[model samples]
Target chain A: MSAAAAKAKRAVRRPVSIASFAQSENVRRDDQHNEVEMLMPVVAEVFANIGITKNDIDFICSGSSDYLIGGPFSFVTALDAVGVWPPMPESHTEMDGAWALYEAWVLLQEGEIDAALVYSFGRSSPGNLNEILALQLDPYYLAPLWPDPVSVAALQARALIDAGKGSEEDFAAIASRSRKDALSNPKAQVAHDIPVETLLRDEYVVSPLRRHTLPPITDGAAAMVLAAGDKAREWSDKPVWITGFDHRIETHSLGGRDLTSSPSTAKAADVAGVADGPIDVAELHAPFAHQEIILKEALGLDDGVTINPSGGALAANPIMSAGLIRIGEAAARIASGQAARAVAHATSGPCLQQNLVCVLEGE
Target chain B: MSGQTTAEDLGPVTTLATPIRLDFEFTPGVAQSRFLRGLEKGRFVGQRCPTCGKVYVPSRGSCPTDGVPTTEDVDLANVGTVTTYCVVNVPFAGQSIEIPYICAQVLLDGADISFMGLIQQIPTDEIRMGLRVEAVWVEPEELTPSLASVRYFRPSGEPDADYETYKDYL
Candidate 1:
């Protein structure tokens, strides 16, 4: 083992804060702009809102998948949108933007860099999103079958019903409420005030998974600035403090695991201290409506929690960026004083195989 | 034992070849659209960064160093200098150009960045840094919104540029 590995554990207590956040308007197809173009305005807005330049940032990390664009080295090309002239420390995650934020958070805990920029973008309109997502499955068994995300999610929904954990009505209700809440959010692509009955009447895209239950195919980008210690206070008067952050992943084998409950989410919640305080709001990255029920239960959130006030992923799911947007949305609420404490969740892999939970609070 | 195994001897095959092919409709975005349109008109257009005043050909909409958009459009001359080059002596699949062809980073005058262009009409050994060159465009009738509109670059016969002129670009 290296000398650094042999050292005593370093408890990172340096408070990190979500200083600023911004997101592009979600659309069905952003034909006018490429991923970099879609991301430029959002990155600019994120930094502009905080009255700082790229020079103020010490580290930059982003999350995106090349599969969406059917190209490689896209993240490297994406740096053009950020203007890495002097060349700064940068990193990327092929998972979700939330994971990028986790990386930046870990970097900050080391107490070296004062701030970091986290951004992500996805254009689901370019390719067959369903077919593209199936590539994420295990190559040996699950992937050869070519089960799309909707079909996989349907299996989870069916499992939920089989276990008596949730009903199809519960899925409709979540979809209805999420879209209704999205009506006020201009960034949401699918927003409406539809009743549960009306939503249920909609035809099922897959068994037990209606068109309303599945997240809208969206092209969008989001950015957030994280600052530590004095920089956080200097940047925002109402800095949203990230009290606890943790992520966990379950087994990749779909047949081997229980689909009804998200044990990974429950574990992440415990590690993130989700039950330590009352959650005034939550932004869960449940691409399918029924999965929201699983997440709410896993996080141990009751009826009092205002879920997905920004319409959640149901309104606009921009693949790689959707998960980070949850964290940003949750922080925005706390920063605005709309909520004192908030829980943000991001999920990846088929049927929530991986999960991340972040607890945000305001002073 | 035989060199090849039978199905019974092979047991369950552990490997699978599942070829996944996905098509995409690429959108080049606003800045590249401008550059492509410029090519359609037989002009080399670039965008200048507002902060640094460095012009980028085929700007992807932002100044990479400053993380800001290059908004100002500047029409550039067809003439430039070869900042760097390599001879493709080895043949490979999807190889369109002949072997020993010169592929070079052409730094257009008044532009801050260099873009790859095929350097031809000269011997491979003759290609060198700071070599002056000029774009040879496609026939006007065949012009389209593509880099192909500028077919290639050839020796401009102008005096070699000072090494300092394009060292930053290199």
Candidate 2:
């Protein structure tokens, strides 16, 4: 390749830093407040952490799902929490808040906006989440059958076992370690330090996967502030720079792809430069215990990397906000001088069909 | 391309209908809980946003403009001005109201936001913007923690409100 063309392809974009992060206490049911009330404190805390106000933000973006709330235009009402008076530029995504963060990152890369606010909220307790999640499947072929999320994850677990890649004991170990780590996380909804042997003794919710392997249904919200270049330096003393970020998705048809492996995650890891340096900490948004094993393999993390230091989605999976919380958890560690470099991962769709990987560093 | 067949050559089209039924129970939040309880007491309770000073009926919990919780409770009069309205002539399944009824956006006195209310005890053609109306409550014995406590609204026999009074609500 010509030097000019190669240089053009290798061009690096402006860096965006995660200046601040905050999240609501993950719980089974927050009966006292609605979506707006749930997000108000989180949004306020995120801005307060950075010593900034809504007027300082150039753009606002949020992530949420209307299906979880049983209403259309749900995010429109959520905008009330951001105090959008004076008419600010804003956008929203129906997917996870991590994708909303990605949108804000892309806008910052344009070098126009100095700072942006990203937030997301979900309340999964008011409805039958298993039945609601089934709606995300193919309406004609899969949804009509009403296969709940646990059963789908069970199928993936069974596939992994059949492929001789892992066992049920491995799944229990992941659960044990995650919940134990969650003991320090005051925001986590489920936290316990039960032994793997005790977890294995429990009855299976579905064949080859026990109740310990599944994630808890949670109601929560999270917010983060992203500032570019000098603005980042002004906000945070230890800014967690987003050095590389990318996301990829595989085919929607579950039967068409290998359930035992995650190709999309591996591809995203490559694009996000996961192996560029030693990873001190990693927060993987794997809702199920076994999926963490699959993601570890996809991201090529070795035994030295500390995984799910905040207990991860298995401890508090709040649907739309869980993925964003993973990004926040990883950045918080780096910002606190606990880690120099980290990797945060988020997944969407059934069986980890879609994935996003972000590499963060404190410089 | 020669293997392609026309629609007429195909025998028939097949389609499947799957009916999905989901049940959910929602708990009214802090602001809504108070609003509903006030309705049970035959009172019209509204909350005012501290930042914008806009009063909202039935308390939206938060102000859409300022994104702050409406803190101060404002007790509004039963009478209101019709900012805009629609005559529902067509019927649908499970509709409680009869045909050709006037459903209007009622801007309550001392409140900035408008709420949907049923206009009754007057001809549909007479229900226009700036028409003053008052709530017609069900008997005290039938009162409940719901908007249904007010059967409907009727002409208050007072002078019509000037259009300028509620034009902003429209």
Candidate 3:
């Protein structure tokens, strides 16, 4: 690569570290409270715990899909948290919270900003979530047919079954494991081990995918604080440094491409170098039970690696925020000396259509 | 998590009934407009990348890798093998098809990539992957000057393709 090309690439991939992180409890559906009110305590605690004020931040970015709120430009209403009176440089992507964090990391790498804030919110209880998610497909061909998320995932699950890689028993085990893990997480909405055998007895939502195979319709918000190398050291004694981050999107139509596996996520993981490095923990954003198995194979994680200490999305899953919180939770482990390195994965669209993978290390 | 307002404050539930007709007189932007205009006459089309010799179905406005336009007009074959598919059991608003229908990605002959369409003229349970399907054309009067002019795909009377051939696609 020429110096100019190398410089441009470096400009896009600077090592930013997580300085602070916080989140609200994921609920079945927060109908009583609005997004802003639900977010204030999370935002305030994250900043206050780090001993920083609004003035200390240089940039803010968010990830959200307007389709969640049944309205467009939903991020505009979130400006109240930043007190935009003294405005700020900000942008948003129609992705999950993890991608928003990626955008902030890119902006920080530009050398213009030392600190940034990333946040996301999603409320799925207001609508029929399974049906609402079908809109994520290609509007021209796939979306008009309205194949829900679970059915698409079931196709993948069936493929896994056909390929002899997984089965309904294995999927039930993942659900049982997640609910058991959620018992320790205060913010987890679905937190109980119902026993895999009992779960397997439940009726299918879309054949091969039982009701327990899906996460509840959750509404919640999450935020993470990022700072450049020097700023990171100043903010905390231990910082979780982002070493590699990459995201890739595939064609939106379901039938136009593969379904048994997630090539987009696998390619993204390869680009992000998740397979090359040593990972002690992984936080994968697999809302459906079966997706967790697919992402595990895509990222090439071993049995040695700890997965979803935050109980995974099957426990909480607040749509847009769930992905970003995965990054935040993974980074927190590294920052707190719980893990030396970790990989965080996020997915959007039907059956993991678009995916982002981020690698972080402790310094 | 910050600055996101509550449900009541989010605003009134204004259901937009806007008919989002994103009809573009797309000048192919870079590829062959001739192939696109052929849709007006209900023709399946593609364009070949001269340098790579790759025939892109719904021919690339630009090559996937080089980002260069494919200019030649290549009217495509109506029949192909299904690479993969999903039963769209759930229905959406403004949907033209019924539920429990099979939607498959058909790799039309001589094309580099597959295109999606409804698998018709067969039982839903019988819509297996790699099933040979021929394009069912719309009536001349119903031709819309778009991809939708092809009513759907039906069994092509060819042998069901062995799954191993398209396993990579799955």
Candidate 4:
């Protein structure tokens, strides 16, 4: 293991495991419900899966963005779905749900809370997501130019091609494999069994990125229950322990960073001890097809490893919740005895500027 | 060597102004849709939480206290008590009302929550907590599925309500 990985392992405090996971059906639009309505069922199911109730949880954290709904404090209203009566201790982050899970994990390490709930929701159908996402860039430089997500990802794809790291056919192959694998995931929004050659023939949304390379604009919510130590063991017969967790971020100035590679993901993987053991499955949150290739290289996974068994983000990318869903998907496999060890990865910002890596094992 | 930049050596730092416009179609969930439909019929409708029995105006579909849907609809009186208020004196980009107007939280009778509304027909100095007010409706032709149907709230000329009546709302 790397020196950094050894140091991270030494910092471990309490063992935390995922007790349960649940998600709403990813769809192009959920006109029938608002953010609160969308999360109600998901929160219920996550708790129910563990045969527990909200009364048993010690803390609640959620992730969401008000920009998606064009309102301030959107999460405050979403909290109603959890019925936080008696005023439960709660927190929120304007980031992907994976960060919220990280916060819960930190709290669990303190040994004060035995269990916590983490959730996130996003409704991209309410507004034009491309324009909304551009606002997340540096307001003075990138936002003024309105560089949408697609164009930014295309730049990364072009960089990969220019650096001889990957080719257009490789991008198509990633997309084809992901969507085809999603056929088994009932909650997935996009699933198909098409050939890679057929996808390559599609018109390009941006140069170096075809329409199939981009993720669908989906509205969805996801929730998970996390318990530490003995509580975790009591909750599930086969607990998926979070052995290692770490995250890193890069500068927002896209031009200053290398676009063809993901240094942040590699650093996080090292700190998370991703290479310490043999990985049976990996669920990478790569919204763009080319991004999956970059992440695979950064994580240093071998051909023998199974990737995106739940189709990954290329199948159902629901903005804020997609990253956390990766962790849940990986943990579910471990809990079901489908895999002994897994690596779940989540990325945020443009060109994978921010990344979180989690290592899980069945016990 | 001393490191410093003289005024003459420094050039002007360029800056640019940009406007961001994002359009959205907000779907008010089941409770809010029902409330809007009630407004079209000149009624104040709210939903009562089954667990807590708290009536939320502009029903938010779920009771935040219990984490359950508020299924029981309750019609509230247009008359309410002003729990608190503020006088807006500054102008903003989208200021529709004139400055120095009273914007108050009105706790409609039978509703557990208070909603923000404009206070009119009373002198600014006369607007106070616990003051009774009634809704002022626009012409029926202008009525739509919006809270705008009620133009504002005016003093009802009744005696101020007891503090106990709106203390919880504040």
Instruction: Tell me, by DockQ, which candidate is best.
Output: 1
* lDDT tens digits by residue: candidate 4, A197-277: 899899989998999999998999999999987889899888889988999999999999998888999999988888888
Tens-digit lDDT string for candidate 2 (A75-142): 99889888888899899999899999999999998988989999999989878999999988888889
Q: Clashing pairs in model 2?
A: none
Residue A6, model 3, lDDT: 43
Off by over 4 Å in 4: A1-11, B1-13, B87-95, B98-100, B157-159
Measured with C-alpha atoms, the lDDT of residue A82 in candidate 4 is 93
Which 10 consecutive positions of candidate 2 chain A have the poorest summed lDDT? A3-12
Model 3 residue runs over 4 Å out of place are A1-13, B1-170
Model 2 spans with C-alpha error above 4 angstroms = A1-12, B1-13
Q: What tens digits encode model 4's per-residue C-alpha lDDT throughout B1-170?
A: 15788755777767667988999999898889999988898889999999889999987788888888888999999899999999988889999998789999999999999999999988898889999999998888888889999999999988999998888778
Residue-level lDDT for A236 in candidate 2: 79
- Tell me the native contact fraction for each prediction: 0.90, 0.58, 0.00, 0.83
DockQ score for model 2, please? 0.56
Candidate lDDT (C-alpha), each: 0.92, 0.90, 0.78, 0.92
If both were scored by TM-score, which would come out higher, candidate 2 or candidate 4? 2
Q: Candidate 2 docking category?
A: medium
Q: What's model 2's lDDT at A306?
A: 97
Error of 2 at A227 (Å): 0.9
Judge candidate 2 at residue A60 and give its lDDT. 94
- Clash pairs detected, candidate 1: A82-B67, A83-B64, A83-B67, A84-B64, A85-B65
